[model samples]
Each structure stands twice: as structure tokens, then as C-alpha cells.
Target chain A: MSRLTSVAGSTRAIRATHKTLSSPWATAGAIVIAALWTLPTFGLFLSSFRPAEDITTSGWWTFFAHPRVTLDNYAATLTATSGITVPQALINSLTITIPGALIPITVALLAAYALAWIDFPGRHLLFVAIFAMQIVPLQMLLVPLLRLYTGGLTVGGVAIFPGFAANSMSDGFAQVWLTHTMSALPLAIFMLHNSLSAIPTEIMEAARIDGAGHGRILRSIALPLAMPTVASYAIFQFLWVWNDLLVSTIFTTGKNAPVTKILADLAGMYGQQWHLLTAGTFLAIIVPLIVFFALQRFFVRGLLAGSTKG
Target chain B: MQAFFSWLASLPNIVQVPLVIAAFLVVVAVIIVLIEVAPRPGTAYTWVRAAIAIGFPVIALAVFGLEAGAAWVFGLGAVLGGGLFWLDARSTKGRGRLIQLALFVSPALLLLIVGLVYPTIKTIVAAFMDKTGNQFIGLDNFVWVFSAGGNGGLISLINTVVWVVVAPVAATGVGLIYALWVDRSRAEKLLKVLVFMPMSISLVGGSIIWKFFYDYRQGNQIGLLNQIVAWFGGEPVNWLQHYPLNMFLLIVILVWSQTGFAMVILSAAIKGVPVELVEAAQIDGASSARRFRHIIIPSIRPTIIVVWVTISITSLKVYDVIAVITAGQNSTSVLGYEMVRQFSLMPPQSGHSAALALLIFILVIPFIAYNARTLKRGN
Candidate 1:
């Protein structure tokens, strides 16, 4: 239903646009490029369905003539007896993703609100500091963090981080959530602040006069006004967490690994086994693709949020 | 607290459900009281505010449980903030604003410091230290990074340069051309999504999908490229095993993933081009290509630069696709993959890894500065 409306919307928008784009040359170019772009995924999708034996001997295009298919690859991949199973990894993805996406947005929203609405000391410096941290390479953080997580950080011979995995965080899932949330905070706060600051000050000031403090004003006026931005950033965070492999790989192993980590494990470790990989790849991407399709508008908005200068 | 965590963890779905609800009620009640009943600053209720602010979180963390700690950690600010507000309501101390903002932003700021800033400093310091990071070796790691013999760091650096130069220009070109071709066309939405869908997939997924295309068999060709080569009366080749061609093949994967981003941003910019300008060019008897050059291209130049720089940064950090496909074999390593590879060894090459990571950081600063400047002007 949404797809139909989007299609109709685009057609209407096309009519409003310069008709030169509908020229035969442009149309042909679009078709050719679109086909070239899509053919690889389509080929893989088709190969994923063919019998395991057929995948080794034939290209996906040949499957059209042979017309053999099976769900065995999916079954086999899902039912892996060792390492991380697909079902287990899928659950792992959710465990990390839900909290990872939620915690950052929750914390960032409050911070962004304070930055935008409150005339606080050092607020300007704080905003700049937070925003500037976005460019710090993830690599720089990984070694020290992994060291701290496992070996514990010591300064003058006293461990501060305690190597949490030695105790409570044995699952490794907690580390994934914590790292993802931390990594996402700067962008979330930056984007949310942009949207929050755009809201007219009068609305917030009016709430203050009505005897509403920061908490009440935030809950009632600011949050509702920032809903679209919140949705946008939430989708962004969701996709970032979903698609991440590096952070997941650094922190997780065994049963705790997320979808990308497991898929990467198969692709990288197994290397040449196409049947399970083709199937596993599809299974891994299905959620993110669904998310992208369902929340396409918000995703784009968030991607472009605060992207334009000044 | 340990027992509390175990109890919380061990509770089954059936029992934990109502427990969570009961816990939620308690938290909500505490929050309401903090909001509704806390007295103003400099009043009789100041001590109560300080106690709740300081004492509750300590209790929450030390005595109650992990679950309660998490809940109270969130309220730690609001509860303590309530007291701070009451005590400094008149701003006589001029610290109310500072305390209020600090409470609100403390969680995010603390996480950033721990997660990003401190580690960044540590990594920089590690770059100057030896592999064990216990002794200061100074400039040796950096010299090794630029040296040809040290872990092929120089090879990785050159390959990264090639990627930044080729991938961004190629991807942005494809994206710009697609955005121009599909703009306002009937199939625009579907076509854009087709180009865009690859992006939603992880880089590893893309590498595997494309790996099949480059997959070579000795006897009867199974891979698409091999089949095409064999059909055209040529021998099937191992695509990624080839030298310069392998780099291009890997770079193509980056382009495939990034083209959609470029297209979307450029398409938006193209759409913003005033129809009057195009119409005016048309009325003046200008050809479509001429109009595109004279009007549309000029209009979206900012978007073009953005897409280019965006893809450039992506290229500099191009690790996952290379990791999945080539594993830096055949001299296909970029800076990011090499850094990870260096760091992942048994004892780990701490200095080399940190140096490579810092190299990437330094390389990215100029692009970011340029982008930030242009974005300001565009706005």
C-alpha cells in the first residue's frame, strides 16, 4: 500500500518536474543503470534458492533454464550446529540493537534539549565539543576499549575498568550495546539539537510561564514538536546498529554475535561456501531492507540532517 | 548487587514480566515525587534534594541491583537536578545554569569521553610506544608505517590513495549521472531504490553477492565474468587475484554501495534546480546537454562536492569489503583493513595499528574541514 502511494506520488511529482527527464535517452539510461545496479543482488537471490550442488556448477542466469529450487540452504544455515546459529544470531542482533538504538537516542534527546532550550553555562562549548567528536576514527577507540574490556586499564598499577567480562558482562552482548550507544551519541545529539534548536523559543518560554519546569516542558512541548526529528534519528540509529560489523565483531563472539558478525564470520571464515553464504546473506539483510523500505522518508531525512552547512 | 543481578537474570519470562512492571511503577512514582514535591532552592528542602541526588544513585548502584541502578542512573540527574534548581533558584551563586545543563548532558558527555576521547588520547600515546605500549619508543611506529618493509604499511597506504582518488570520482560520477537521468522520470522511485537497496545491505553481504560474479572455475566457468570471458573466446581469470585490476574490482564494490548515497543527495539538489532555468535554456534553443552543463550542473555543484567528499571519506575507511573479499591478499589492502589486520595479530602490532589509525584520522581532517566550510556557505 505504501509502495503504491509512493509510486503515485512520484508520478505526480514527475509531472510537476521538467519533462526533459522523461526523454527517451534519459529513460533508457535509467533502465540500463538500474539493471546493472540490481543484477548482482538478483543473481545472488536466485542462486540462494537453487540446490547446493547447482550453485557450484552454474551461474544464476542458467537457473532460469534449469528451474530447480530448494529451501535447504536456508534451513542448513539457520540450523548450524556449532558457532552461532542464524536464529540465535538474529536474537543477538535484537538484544544489542534495541538497547543500543534506544539508549543513545534517549540520552541524546535530553542533552540536545538542554543544549537547545536551556540558557546554561558552557552550553556553547559543550555543543561544539560534542559535535567535533564525531570525526574520531573508530579504530583509535577499538584497541584501548578492547584492552580495557578484557585486560582492564591500569594507571600506576590500579585497574579502573575491572575487565568487566571477568565478572558480569560475560555474555559480551553488553559491550556491543555500550559501544554502539556511545558511538552513536554524537550524531544523535547533533542531529536532535539541530531539530530542537529550529523550534521557536516562544513555545518553550510560554510553557515556562505556565509554571512548567524543564521536565514538564520537555515532556509536553519539546518532545511532541521534535517527534519527526526523533523518528528520523531513531531510524538512523537503528540502521547504524543493524548494519554495523566492526563494533559487533570487536565486542562479540560465540552465541553473542549479531547478524552481521555471524554473516561476516561465515563469509570470512568459511570463505568459499556459497550456498550457506548466499542464504545467510539474505537472511541477514532482510530486517535492514524492511526497515529501509518502511521508514524510507525518515532515513533520508536523518542522513541529510544537519548535513547542509551553516 | 551480584546476587541481585543473578536473580534478575535468572527470573523466567513468566515471573520477570510482573516484576518489571512493579519496578516500573516504583520508578515512575519516585520520578513524580521528585518533580511534584521537591522544594525550591535556598529553602528548607535543600538538604533533602542533595541527599536524594547524591545518596539515591549510590544506593541504586551499590545496594539495590543492576536493574535498579540502570533506572536510578537515569533519574540521578533529574532528582539531584531538582535539588540544585531549588537551592539556586535565584541564580545568586550563578551556578544553577551550569548544574542544570551538566545534569542533563552528563550521560552523553561521559560516554563520549570514555568511548571516544580518552581512547583517542590513549591511541595517540600508544602510537609513540612500542608493541607492548609500556615503553616510549617515539617516531619508530610512524617511521615503520611509511617504511616499505614494515608490515606492508606503505603498500596499504598507496592502495588507499588509489581508492580515494578512483572510488569517489567513479561513484560520484555514476550517482550524478543516475540522478540526472532518473530525475522526474516515471521510474525514478523504483530506479533510485534499485540503486539504493545495495546500500542497506552490509558491505560483507555486498562482497559475497559480488564474489559470485568474480567466482572462477577451471573447467566450465561458473562465475558471470568468467562465463562472459569464456563465451567471448578468452580464458576465465581469477578476478581478484589480478594486481591493478583487483584493486578496481574491490573499488567497484565501494562504488556500488556508495552510488545510491550520491544519487539521493544529487537528485535532491537536481530537483531544486528552478524549472524556469531549464525552460529558459530550452526556449533559447539550447540542447539538453548544454542546458545540463549551463544550468543543472552548476546548480548542484554543492551537492556534487558533498557527495564526492562523502565518498572520499568512505574510501579512506574502506575496510569491510576488502576484508570480506580479499582479506588484504594480492596487495589489495587499504589503511583501514591493514590497521585491523595489524591489530588482530597474536601479540598485536600496537604501534603500527595506532599509527595507521591516526593516519586515517589525519587524512580525514582536511576533507571534513572542507565539507564543514562548504556546507556553511550552502546554508
Candidate 2:
């Protein structure tokens, strides 16, 4: 009883120490750091609203003195004709991201279930292999994977699998989608397996004894239990695919390019055009921002669980 | 109905995206349903399953057009469907478990084999071949990579070393400091969001934001960095044009974006540090700095290493930022950008690109090994 009281007393003391630690200096330092971190983005965001002349000539901070705002930059960026427009890139982003996120989760959930619950040969080896595959950087796979998409896989001069022929926009979408799904699987399976395997074996055994097949058990029990994890991973993968520039730049054509690709092109070709660049950047950023703020909790949970890249 | 079909076909591609995704989802739902219901004790259901499985390829062919690619899909689908039907038939006779395992696992395994594993092996092989990937020119590509000259592989190698070393350390240090400061403080959530917001922005967007900051106008200074320098009676510097400083300036963009990631992960780790240990140390008359150094750092060392390695790997693969900001000009070329640049060349130096990729893969191996060791130890 005395030991328990002593432990409680220490906890109270620690709480008091925490309060004292948050001195005025700490607060001021934090505010300064926050301002430094936020200023660049804030400047660009504010510049996106300024007129083209003002944005190019005066500092974004000068906007405080003048206080001018206009949607012309956004209008011009969305309606530009020299290249792929912002709206078209937005559509392409959705096309790539939705299926890119969904297909992997569906495939990984099944794989995770089997790895977690099924009594199978080589299960541990397979799990370890998938885990290791998570570290295989995307660069290692890009060249050959592109070949596999453009030219069929061949062994000893015999074609085993005919490659995807990108004759339409959907085919381009399919290539990007397949690439994202493949890259995302290892991490997805690892994460979902961790969560699914944590489900009590006793519950699984009880269901098995009641004559529930694996499919039924997965659908009725494991799926519901793992839905939170699945949701979090979904949000993570969605943001990842949306924010991705490397894959989309390599995979998609002009019309099928996502917003990130278009934005990169704009930044490269017209670096001096801050008005269009700023608005285009914000337009590209808006969707992920919405998803981030709306699902920040799940996103953070998934990030902590699986911190590696797709 | 005919008019409606025509209208649907005439809709813009943007409008068709949802319909396409919906169709894709329906196909996935059908597969799931087939897996669930195929084992039912009914011959009628089995026949229906077989019919639907066979009919899917036909529908795919019809929708995608009767092309050679569709023919391969048709053949593959028929074989896969037949195999599944055979398994489903035998599943009731004490083979149900194996069938379920195969059904649950084969899609993922097949995709990984075809997409990741096969391509990795092929990349390793292509690294030995010539520019056309047809001739065996062993070690030549690697020689070119390590060749010492202007904008050569050696320079890229040195820059990457600098990047991997400096970016992760600075980002992790800043993140650790921020996490410590904001621990249990008021407005913690808001403070965290300000830092973490960049994690959501595309690297492309982040580069654009920083480009504006590094923008150097000769006359009246527009860029914040230049304006501040002007305030202190300094000439406006071309931040991205200077050689060694340009590399570090590029590194700053990565640090700014990734500091949030490090902070969040380290903040979680800091929270996980035992309060009782700290209190005990306090009772022993340890100062706050001593408690932090001895207690908190040791407790979260594993997490810090993980965060550092994760960021290092990201720094190694830093492509989009370089591609956007400098396009590998001013001696800022790194392995990731060089690999893509080599591959995208007119003749397409497949061997050189492959060599660069393999180098990156080799560099990454140690990090993964360390991570695996730590994971096993933790377990």
C-alpha cells in the first residue's frame, strides 16, 4: 500500500513538473518556429490571390499594405490552353488515386487474412519476404516494370505474358493503377497482417468450431474488426497516390497526367510565372488538404503504424 | 435505352471516371462474392460460378475490343477460372482449407511475382547489358557511373552522400527539438499541424513554394529570403545557382517537408517514454537536461534511428524536388534524378540507369538490414 501511494505521489509530481516546464520562453520559441515553418507556404498561398503584376513585382508581404485579392490567377491556371489544364489533371488524379488505393487494399486484406489466420506451409517465409519487399526502393523496379508494361515478359525467347498495350487513356490509367497497387502491397499487407493477427485466436477457434468457413469468418468477423485499420491505410495510400509525382510523370501521357505532373511541368517551363504557378500549386494541394484535415486522425494512426513509403 | 447508351458514350472522359471506377469496384465485388459462395453445396451454384467466370473474360473482350491483348486475357481467365472450379469442387472433400488459402493469397502473390520480383531480377540483369539492353558489356556502365568529371556519377555520389548525411540529421534534430518543446503544451495540436501540413503537399508543390522563397530579383527583392538579406544590407543571392550552397539549399527543401514526418514519429516516441522513469530521475536530483539526455534519449533511441533511416531513404530517392527546382543543374545531380535522366535520354542508357538503380539498391540494403535486426530484437 505504501509503494502504491509512492507511485501515485511520483505521478502527481511529474504532472506538476510538466506544468512548470512550459515556461513563457518555451511558448515564444515555439511560436517563432511555427512562423518560420509556415511563412513560405503562407507567402505562396497569399501570392496566389494577388494580381499578376503585383505578384511578380512586389513581395507577398506587401499584400498586407495593399490588401488586394483576385481569382484571376486561378481562372487562368484552370483554363490554360498551351498545355494540360488544371481541371483535366484533377480528373486524372482522381482516376489514378481511387483505384490505386482500393485495388491494393482489397488484395492485401485477403493476403493479410490468410497470413494471419490460415494454417499454411511457408507462411512465415512468405510474410518475411513481403516485409523485405517493402524496402525494395521504387527506383529498382521502374525500368524493368516499364518494360513489362510496354513489352511482354519473355524467358528464353518465349513470351510468357503479353504486356499491357496502352492504346487508350484507360490503359494509361491501368498502368499507373497497377504500378501503385504493386508498390503499395508489401506495406499494406504488413500493416493489415499486424492488425488481423492480433485478433484473439480464441474467437477464431470458436467460430471455426461453429462450422464457419474462412470466407464467412473473414467477412463477418475479421473484416469488421480490421475496418478501422483498412480505413486508415486507405487514407494513407490515397494521399500517397495523390501526392505522387514520380510514378505519374513516368507513366502517364500528356492528357492523362495527374496534377502533380502538370504542376512540375509548369514550374519547369514557366518558373517566372508565379501567378499561374502559385494558383496551380494550390489547386493541386486542395484535395489532399481536405482529405488530410478531414481524416487527420486515421492518417496519423496509419503513419505511425507504417512509416515507410509505398 | 439506345439514346441513353449513346449519351453515356458521348459524356466527357472526366465524367466517365466515376462510372469506370464503379465498374471496377463491381468487378472486385463479384470476385469476392464468388470466393464466398463458390463452395456452397449446390451443383447449380457451381455451374453459375463457372459461367460467370468464363463470361467475365468474354465481357472484357467485348468491352475492350477484340484485340490480341484481349485474347491473352481470355485464355488466362479461362485457365484461372477452370482451376478455381476444380478447387471448389474438391474443397468439400476435406480440401477446403487449402482452397481457401489459395483463393485468399494467390492474387497478391501473383501480382508481386509479376510486378516486383520479376522486374527486380530483370533490372539486375539489365545492369550488365549495354545501352540497348541487348549486348553484355559488363562493368562498363558502372565505370561510367564512378568516372570522375564534371556532373559525372562521382559528383552525384558525393552529393547524395552529403544529402543522406546532412538532411536526415538536421531534420531529425529540428524535429526532436520541436517535439520536446511542444510536449504537453497548450496549442500543441495547432503547432503540430503547422509543421505537419507540408507532409500532405506534393514534393512538387513544396518545391514551388520554396522556389518562390529562393527567388532572386536583382532590383526590388520579392523573395522573402532575398528581402531579409536586403534588410541586413546584403546582396540578393541566387540561392539555387550557387554550387555547394545550391545542394544544401535543395536539402533544406527536403528538411522542411520531412521535419514534420520526423516530428510526428518522434513525438509519439517521446510520449511513449515512461513518465515514472523521469520522475524517478528527478527524485534522484537529475536536472532536466540530464534527464533528457540520459532517460528520454535512451528510451526513444530505437525510434529515432528508425525515423532517421526512413528519412535517409527518402533523401536518397529525392527526385521530384531536384527535378522541379534545379533539374539537376549546378552540380545538384543525385542518383535518383540521374537514373531517370539516363533512362529518358534519346538513346536511353538502360545499362547506366540500371547501374545507378543498383547502386541505390546497394546503399539501401544496410538500412534494411539494420531495420530487420532491430525489428527482431524488438520482437
Which pairs clash (backbone N, Cα, C closer than 3 Å) in model 1? A309-B375, A309-B376, A310-B376, B40-B86, B41-B86, B41-B87
Model 1 lDDT tens row, A1-310: 2322343455444456556546878879888999988888898899889998898877788887889989999999877633868877877777667767877887788789888887756779988888888788787788888876666555445443345445334454546766887888888898889878878878877887888866677778888988988997888788778888778767876767787878777877776678888898898889989999999987776666545431
True contacts kept of 2: 0.51
**lDDT at residue A225 of model 1 (Cα atoms):** 85
Cα RMSDs of all predictions?
4.9, 4.7
lDDT per residue for candidate 2 within A1-310, as digits (tens), equals 2322343456545556677656666667777888988999999999999999999999999888999999999999878743679988898899789888988999999999999987666999999999999777888889887877666555455444445553222334667888999999998999999889878999999998998877788889999998888999999899999999889877887877889998889888888988899999999999999999999988877887775321
- What TM-score does structure 1 among the candidates reach? 0.90
- On the 0 to 100 scale, the lDDT of residue B191 in model 2 is 94
The residue-by-residue lDDT of candidate 2 on B206-226, one tens digit each, is 999999999997788779999
